[model samples]
Target: MSHPQGKELSIAVVGGGISALAAAHRLVELAPRCRLKVFEATGRLGGVISTVHRDGYQIEQSADNFITTVPHAVKLCQQLGLEHQLVETNPQYRRTFVVRQGRLHKLPDGFLMMAPTRLWPLAVTPILSPLGKLRAALEYFVPPRRDDADESMAAFVRRRLGGEVFQRLVEPLVSAVYAADMEKLSVLATLPRFREMECRYGSLIRAMRAQRRLHPQTTHESGARYSMFVTLRDGLTSLVDALAARLPPGSVCLNTEVVGLQRA
Candidate 1:
C-alpha cells in the first residue's frame, strides 16, 4: 500500500459489475492498507447479473451459471467462502435443444458448439438439411486458413463448414449461450480452440474426431459440457453481496459516473 517514497497508495475502481467488484476484492486482499474506492454509475450493484426470487422460484436476469472448466470463478467462490453454496446442474436436464421449424430437436451427440466429434450423429441430425449435412461433413476436406488474422464467428464457420451449418447449427447453439451476434463475435475471443484445431489438424472435423478417439467418454456428449457448469443455490447475486461485504464501509460510491480520468 506504500509507494517507494513511503506515501500511502490510493486506488479507484470504476463500475459495480462483477468484474469490477472482483478486481476491487483482489486489490483489498493484496493491499489491505491502501485507500480504495469503487464508483458505480448505477444505483444498484451486480450490473446485469441479478437473481430475482418470486413465489418459490429463482429467476436469473442474465448469466445464471459459470463453467468450472475455468478455475477462476470456482477459485473466487472458494475465496469468498461460498463453496458450500455451489450447486451443480441437474443430471436429468443436462442437454441442449435447438428449435427447427417449430420443433425442438436435440443437438447431435458429440457436437460441441461448432465441431462434431461423431460423423454418424451429425449425418442424421434433423437440425440440418441433407445438403447442410453433406456440407458439414465435407469440412474434413476444406483447407485451413493459415493466417493469424481475426475473423467473425459467422465467417469462420461458414468458411470452414458451410453457410448452412453456420446458420442452422452453429449460429443457434453459440448464440443461445453467448447471446451475441455471430457476425460481430470474434472467433479468437470466444472459441479460439476451434481455430487452433483447424490450424493443427487442417480441419475442424478431423480435429474433433481425433479428440473423440483420445477421450472416448465424451462420445455421447453434445453441445457444451453442461456438467461443468454450476451456480449458487441462493443465486448469482450472492457473489456480488459477498464481495461488497468485504469492502470497507463508505468505500462504494453508487450513481457516480466517471466521465474522464486525468493523471495526477
Candidate 2:
C-alpha cells in the first residue's frame, strides 16, 4: 500500500456497516476531490445495522448504542447536523441488561465493563453456588496475580469463581456483546481491560468499586435522562436512504457481483 501525500485518491468501502458509512462520510469531508465508492453486498448499505419504522414502531438489527463515554458516535451525530435528533435511551430502561428466568436481576450497580467488584449482591445472588460465591468472594482477599497473561471468560470465571457464574452471568453477558460463544472467546480481544483492572487495583472488584467512586452517578442511573439502548426516531433506513441520495449519478452498478480482484 502506498500513502500519497498532497494527492487525491479513489477509495472503495465494502460492507456498509456503521464503520463503512462513517468512512465514506469522512472521505467526503477530507477528500471530496477523491472518488468514493461503497460496494455493499445487499441492495442497501448499513448491513446488519439498518433500522426500520412501521406505524409507530422502530426496529433495529445490530450496531446499537455508541457508548456515551466514547465520543465518536455522538460527535458524528453532531457533525451530521443531527444533534437535535439524538435521543438518549429511555430513562426507564437505561440501567437494563436481560433476564431469562423468573426473577428480575439487576447487574450490580457501579459494575462497569462486565466485572463485579462490589460484594453484597455477588455473595447473595442465586446465580452462583455457595462455593462459587465463596470463591468469587475470595477475590477481595486474594492478592493479584501478574504471571498469567490471559484467560477466557469461561475459564476466568470458572477458575476464580465457578461454572454457574460462567454459564449464567458471564456467558449471557459476553454473548450479548459478541454474539459469540464464551468457551472459545478471546479474553484479550474482548476484555483487555481485565489485565489493566487487575494490575491497577490488585482485584477486579476493587477496580470496579474505584471506577464507581469516580462515576457514582452511572451506578444509580434509574430515571436518568436517556438510556443505554437507543435508536433514531425515523427508523434506521432514513440514514441509508440519505447516504444513497448523496452519491453522484451513475455511481452505482446494481444487480452485479464481482467475485475477485487483481492488479493488471
Candidate 3:
C-alpha cells in the first residue's frame, strides 16, 4: 500500500509477538507520519520468548539463543543497536550429548546434524557400531535421487546413510529439534539443505566438505561452533523490550483480543 506524504494513515497491528513487534517497527520506519496501534492479548509481550531474573540468577524461560547461519535474527539485533550486547556460546562446552542405553555420549566432532565431516571422529565414536559407521561412511558413494518430489526426512536419511545410522543418531537428533515423527516430517519443509546437498553434490558429506572449504573460518575449532549461536548478554527478551520501547506511547493496547479483520 502506498501512503502519500502528510496524509494521516492509520495502521492497526494485531498481536504482540516478536513478529508483530517487528512489523510495527517496520511500519513506523516506513511511514513515520502514520498513526499505528498495537493490540496484545496478554499483559506482557515476547510470546514464548521470556526472560526472568530471580535469586541473583538470570534465566531464559524460552528461546535462549538463535543460530547465525540464518542472519535475520542477527540483522534484527543490529538494527535494534544491540549488537554490542551480543554474546557467543562458550567454546569450552559446545558438544551435544545424546543418551544411549542409559549412557550419555558426546556427539561426534564434525558431525553436523545428519552428516559427518570428519571420518576419524566417526571411526572412534562408540555411538555407532562398526557396521553402522561403515554404512554412514558409504554416504559419500551413494547416488542421489533425481526426483524433485518431496520426501520424508526418515526416508532420506535411511536411503543415504542407512537404517542403523537413522535409528541411533539421525532419529534422536532430529527428534530433539522437531519433536515430530520423522516418517511424517517432510525434509523439504524442515531442512531442505540436506535435500539440496543430495541433488547438488550427490552426498551430504561432499556438500559439507565443500562448504567447509568455502568458509574454513567457521570450522577452525572443534565442538559447538560458538559463532553459529548468538544471544544478548542480558537475555533474548531484551530484544522485545527494545522494540516495545520504540513504539509511540498510548499506541499499545494490552489484554485486547482481536477476533478478525475485514478490509473496509
Candidate 4:
C-alpha cells in the first residue's frame, strides 16, 4: 500500500505462530500492496500448535480447539473461507473430570470456573465437604475488600471464599488450567473479572447473579459450551495452510529469527 508520502509501505512480522500469521493476514487485508516479510526462526509454521496425522487419527500437540464465544478465531476462519471446515465438539461427553483422591470426579454442573452460579448443583456436588460447601455458600454474605490492590489467585480465592473452598475447589481447578503456582499467579493478570466482581457486588455469587440478570447469556450459556469450541474438520493445519496460501509468493523467510527491533 502507498504511504502518506506516496511510497510503498513495508512491514516485518517475526514469527510463524498463529498469532503472527493472523497479524500478517490483517496487515495484508488492510494494505493490499504492502511489502510484507514474515521472518520465522523455525522451518515450519504454527509454532507449538502442531498437528500430526498418524494412522487416520489426528493428534494435536498443544491446543486443539478455539472458543467461538470471543469471535476472533471463528471470524478469521470465516474470512479465510474455512467455514465449511469448522466442526464443533461432540455434544455428548462435554464435561471435564477432576481427579480427587486418585478417583476421577466430574466437575459440578453450573460451576463457572472458580464459583458456582447455581445453588442446586453446588449443593449436590460431592467435590467439597459439607463444611466446605457451607463456606462457599457463605461467599454471598462475605463483604468485599474496600482497598483496590492486586492480589495473588490463592489469596483472592481464600479471602473471597474460604480456605477449605480454595483448597478443595479453586486451587485444583486453577492448577489444572494454568499449571502455575497459585501464590505467583496474579489474580489481576489472570482473572481480573473476579476481582472486579468482588469490588462491585461484594461477592462472587452476587456478582454472577447481577451479571446473569444484566445479560441472560451468562446464565443460559454457563461454563463449557462445547459448541463454542470449534476446530477445522481437517485439523488446525488447514488454517495455517489457508493463511500461508494468502501471503505473497516468497514473503515468508524461514529460519530468520528476530531477537529485537531498532528504530531507523
Candidate 5:
C-alpha cells in the first residue's frame, strides 16, 4: 500500500503455514495494492494442518478442530466467506475420558482443564481416589501464590490440586492437548488465566465455582471445553486454499528457505 512518503510498501512473510498465510491475507485486505511475497521451506502449504481423503472418510494429520473460545479462527473463516462450512462437535459426545489402570473413565463434569466448577461431579468421579478427591476439594482453601514468577504446569497443578490429581487427571488431559513435558511447560505461557484466578479469588476451586455461578451453562460441562470446538466440513485444507486463493498471483514462493539476513 502507499506509505506516508507516497511509495508502495512491500512485505515479505516467511512460511506457507496457516498462520503466515492468514497474515498475508489480512495484509492484502488492509492494503489491496501492497506488494507481498510468501516464502515456504517446503513445496506445500498448511504445515501440519493437512487433511487426507480416502475410502469416503476425511483424515486429519494433526489438529482436527479449533476451539471457538479464541474467536480468531472463527473470525478468519467468516472473513473468508467460509462460515457456512464450519461444523460443531457432536453434542452427545462432547465429554472427554481419561484412562486409568487400562480403563476409560469420564472426566468429571464441569472440570475444565485444571479446575472443577462443580464439586459434586469431582467428588463422584472414579478418576481420583478418596484422598485425591479430598485434596482437590482442599484447593478451595489453598493460599494463592502471590508472586508473578513463572512456574511449570506440573508444579502449578501439584501445588494447588495435589500430586494425585496431577498424575491421574491433569497430566493426561493437558498432555493430550499440548504433547509437551509438564515439567517444562510454562503455566504462564499456556494457561495464565488459572494463575489469574488464583490471584483474584485466592483458590482455584473457589474461582471456578464463582465462574460457574456467573456462567451457569458451564456447570454441567466437562474437560477441555469441547462445546467451543469446531472444524471445517470439507477439511482444514479448505482454509489454506481459500487464503492462498485470496493472495495476489505469484505471491507464494515454495521451497525457498531463508538461511540468513543482512542489512541491504
Candidate 6:
C-alpha cells in the first residue's frame, strides 16, 4: 500500500482476524507488490473464532457454525476444497428451544420469529396469554404504522406481537444470539428485511406466508440439501488450517503481535 505520497508500497491491516487475513490475501491476489501486512493485538490470530480440543471435546470459542443458506461462507468452503469435511446439523433437531419461566420450552414449528405461518399452534402456545395472542392476531386488521422509522428489537416485537411475547419469547431468543439488551439492538440494523416485510404487508404472518408462497420450493421442497448450521468435520480449526495452507511460503506470520498504530 504505497501512500499516494510515500515511496514504500505497503499496506497496514489491523487485527490478524479473518477480515485482515482475507484483506491481505485479496491484496496479494490483486496487487502482489502491495506489501500487505496484518497486525494483531493478541498473541493469536483468528480473533474470537478459535477452537480448543481437550478431554476429547472440541469447543468453539465463538461462532459455532456458519449457516449454509448464506452463500459467502459456502463459497469460501468450496474455494478451500473443504467440501468433504463440511458438517451439517441434524435435521431432526431443527427445532430450537427457548428459555421461558426458568425452563427451556420448544419453540413451535413453523413459527418464524414472531410471525406464525400456522395459527392453531401459536394460538395454543403457552409462551403467551390468550389476550396477548389476540393482540398479535389483530395485526392483520391494523394498518401498518407510519412510524416505521428504526425501532429497537423489543419495541418491534412488542408492537407486532405483544408485551408477553416480547418479554418471554423474543427477549430470550435475542439473548441466545446477540446477548444484548433488546432495547439496544436496532431492528432495522439487525433485521431490516423484517422492517420491509411489515411495511409491505400489514401483518408479519401475512408477509412470511406470501414470501413462503413465492419461494415455496425452498421450504416445501422435500429433501432440501444442506443444513442451516454447518462446520468442518475435524473442527473449525481445520477450516483455518486449510486457509493457512493456501498462502505462499513466508507469507503468513505466527506468534506476531502488534501494539500501536499511527500514520507517518
Candidate 3 collision pairs: none
Give one digit per residue, the lDDT tens place, for model 2 in 1-264. Answer: 223665557676665656777777777777667666676666766667767667876777665554565577667766666667666666445554437487767655433445664577666665567876777767766676677567776776566555765666667667776788777777777677776787788877788788768866566442112344445556555555556555655554444455665432
Off by over 4 Å in 5: 1-10, 262-264
Worst 10 residues of 2 by lDDT: 221-230
- The per-residue C-alpha lDDT of model 5 at residue 120 equals 92
Local distance difference test scores for all models: 0.90, 0.63, 0.84, 0.81, 0.90, 0.70
lDDT (Cα, tens digit) per residue for candidate 1, span 1-264: 567777777889999999999999999988898888999999999988999999999999999999998899999999999999999988666667888899999988888888888899888888889999888888989989999999999999999989998887889989878989999999999999999999999999989989988988767778787788999999999999999999989899999998987654
Tens-place lDDT per residue, model 5, 74-101, is 9999999999999998877777799899
Residues 1-264, candidate 3: write the lDDT tens digits.
455554578899999998999999989888787788899999988887899999989898877888899888889889999999999987666667778999998878777777776778778888899999999999999999898999899999999999987888778877766668999999999889889988999999899888888766545344445458988999999999999999988889989988987742
TM-score order of candidates, best first? 1, 5, 3, 6, 4, 2
Worst 10 residues of 3 by lDDT: 217-226
Instruction: Write candidate 6's Cα lDDT for 1-264 as tens digits.
Output: 345766656667777677677666667666666665666667666777789999999888876677776687777778789888888876665555776678877665556655666566668778778898898777677667677588888888888877877776667666556658889989988777777888888778789778778765334211112246688887776766666665555665556665676664
Clash number for candidate 2: 2
* TM-score per candidate, chains pooled: 0.91, 0.78, 0.83, 0.80, 0.87, 0.81
Task: Choose the strongest candidate by TM-score.
Answer: 1
Candidate 6, pairs of clashing residues: 1-10
Q: Between which residue pairs do clashes occur in model 4?
A: 1-33, 1-34
Enumerate residue pairs that collide in model 5.
1-34
lDDT of 4 by residue, 73-150 (tens): 988999999999999887565666666888887777656667766677778777788888888889999889888788
